[model samples]
Target: MSRQIQSRSYLIPIHLDENHWSLLVFNINSKQIINFDSLYNIDKNIAIISNLISILSKYVTVLKGAQNWNFFQNYSAPRQSGDIDCGVFVCQYANEVHSILNMKQFDIICFCETKIEDSYPNSFYKNDYYYKIRLDRSRHGGGLIIFIKNSFVLTKSVHPENTELIYLQFRKSGQLNNFIYTFRAPNLKEQLFLEKLEDFIHSINLNEPLFIVGNLNMDFSDKIKSNISKFADHNDLINFVKTPTSI
Candidate 1:
């Protein structure tokens, strides 16, 4: 017996015969029933969720409203290290799903010249709802950090060697890749900086959207003074900052 629920998505916790716990996230819009199991026991977990979905499909309301709903087991979900922690993993997975469904306005945040030390503990700026990536200054007076909403899955984080830049790749619910680059130029070596920056830009895939941000110490108004403009033109990057950020 299924009751009609009027929600865009549903989160259901499943107990595996009182031994293990898992989560089922059903999105009515996508018609996807995703299983997040800490154990990653595909055969057993899929069987359980499939049985539940089959039962739900038998309901007149669900059958009429959503037909041929697909079931997917998330293999990338964090697995529990111990046998007794499946319950905790289930709760965390449910919370993550909740955050994804009700996301905030800002998905990505970047900071340059953060002056953060390598030894600095992440807990100082850690937000439970966001993923934090930090790059400490190599010499002095240069550091970078980025915070992305946990709702968006982080596919990769790339930090180029001998450079003050960090590139992060993210995806939202199986969407296309999103690349974000954060950089801060050193006070000296202007030519070397541009050359290295150009190399980094050349490495990126232009088909996907790439956001390059940070304090480059260049005035965008002056094309010659700001060598970045040339690189931007070469790489087909646009400067969204129309107004002067500094005098």
Candidate 2:
């Protein structure tokens, strides 16, 4: 029994730092973040209820099973977003970031981080190598991001209506199943997962603009950046950078 959806779209955020100092905000469609002056008497840790008018303004709802922050699926269905109706699907591994995020809103959610990896891809990229996407290094990092389009159309794919694609930026023989995928040994598991996710995107012939954002652990290299730009240009997707860190 899937939960009912009551909204159109919701904001989903995931912060990797385990400390409560970091925040994961969801469903704030109306307002953006505000900086408050230091309060001498108030405890910043307190989770205070916002004013009713504000609460109605799309505050956060903690979910049990969401990838990244895609757990707000309880809004509505046929589950179509975008102008042409190519369905919406989001997948990610939350264990590396948090316990779990759940709701009946997301179409496909895979918890890949908790899986076993014999070795890791860490040697290739130093821990500090910065890519816009952050993958978990401690684990084999079968961790990935994918989107599905048009989930209503029935087929052999995970989401019948949507085209699913891996945002991992791998140029291989279709994810892990390709000959090169297994060579990574312990990393094979991650490769295989990527292959499966690639299958999800192809099923729908989906070509839409998608924004894949997260702590991918893979730092940005000049070539990697160029490749990403090309893909986005080909697909009509543009990269959006949050304001850069201030001194």
Candidate 3:
């Protein structure tokens, strides 16, 4: 008889920005960086951009929250730092650079379009888009719901069978949280989407480490966006960006 094989999961967010960027590999075991990479030069466009893209090619290794921190401390992949065309970075690989990364096989889901220069990028068939996307083949602009096959899933909202996702949208005036808006402030539809997303991510547990990456478009300063980080990071779900955020 074949024995059951356990899978691991990690909640990683490769904070995507159009400005100076970075790659953070968090240890699911310790809830910290196993390795990290950031842009080397922003002033020099060509050379800097070239190096950043090359460095980003490296892959990464993912661990689970239950894995002991000491083990991760002993085993880590070399990381790279650099800038790119401004899209979502891969969160799973062996070296955090120079490796083939994939997002198509996971149970993840997300929006296909984003607000571009003047309007929502409505064309779905186009390949090159403006949002933080996981891979080049995707359309809806940018976002990823990466997962290791057979790994644990975390979330509060009901999901479609065999899908890794929950919708994160803004709260309308009729909702119960409307009162809370008077006491504080209500989150944008996108911000609320993340809050719901985080809650769903936290609802499940895992046997091994996992990494989550996508466009959160949130900052620590935004009370609403901050809430999503709170729920995920509380269980050791680490995020790469902590500074004030903007589009």
Candidate 4:
């Protein structure tokens, strides 16, 4: 017989009759009962469920009365391979159910994003790579910064005056080849930004790989789009991303 269980507690009962063992899980909060056995029959299983419910009703009563039990008709569970494997199978089933419950509870408490307010020299700075950052020096309106972290030597890339793009090159063993560029394109400065980008591209050696990533807020246009496509094609650079990043 069942009694009043603790709130949110799950009771996994192992029922053994002579040589056979079966498993059942009872959730106190939701009043959900799950039964697992190697074999089943529709009529016999319904009778077993009814008997279990009657046994539980003898010791305690629910706030919603004894008529609200979920018998879970047409139930299906994992089967045992042999006569002696039923206990092992029940243990496995209970372990899997407990892991699933733990994962569900963790999902409710896990964090998505974290904000860092400290300046530098934090715990993460002493990892595999050294760090260099450029902070925004603007008084009020526009503020921007750049962060470069890698094993290779890094230097601030030279660009045309009054350009919005920020470029950084990675050098190793006194050789500068790899580069990364980022930009935040404003609508009013689109023309000047494109011109500056063109000038910078022409100034660099196109034989090495270059990764450029940012939100260039320009749509399909003959001026900027055509020039960018031509530059990428001429330099053997591939644009692997073809999907819309933001809606």
Highest-TM-score candidate: 1
Question: What TM-score should be assigned to candidate 2?
Answer: 0.26
Task: For candidate 2, write residues 14-65 as lDDT tens digits.
Answer: 2121211111234334323321111111144223312221343333342322
Model 2 ranges off by over 4 Å: 1-102, 110-112, 116-139, 143-154, 158-226, 238-247
The RMSD of every model to the true structure, in order and in angstroms, is 18.7, 17.0, 14.8, 23.6
* lDDT of candidate 3 over 1-247, digit per residue (tens): 3233222333232333333233334444344433223332223443433333334333223333223333122123333333342223222232322121233232223322111222324332222211122222222233222222223222222232222232222122332110000001122454456555545555544433444544444455545646655656565766555443222
RMSD of 3: 14.8
Compute each candidate's TM-score over C-alphas. Answer: 0.53, 0.26, 0.27, 0.39
lDDT of each: 0.68, 0.28, 0.33, 0.47
Ranking by lDDT: 1, 4, 3, 2
Task: Tell me the tens digit of each residue's lDDT in model 4 across 25-49.
Answer: 5556667666666654335555655
For lDDT, candidate 1 versus 3, the one ahead is 1
Error of 4 at 112 (Å): 20
* Candidate 1 C-alpha lDDT tens digits along 17-111: 44566788878788887888888876865665666666655553544434367778899999988776665576467664435424444577665
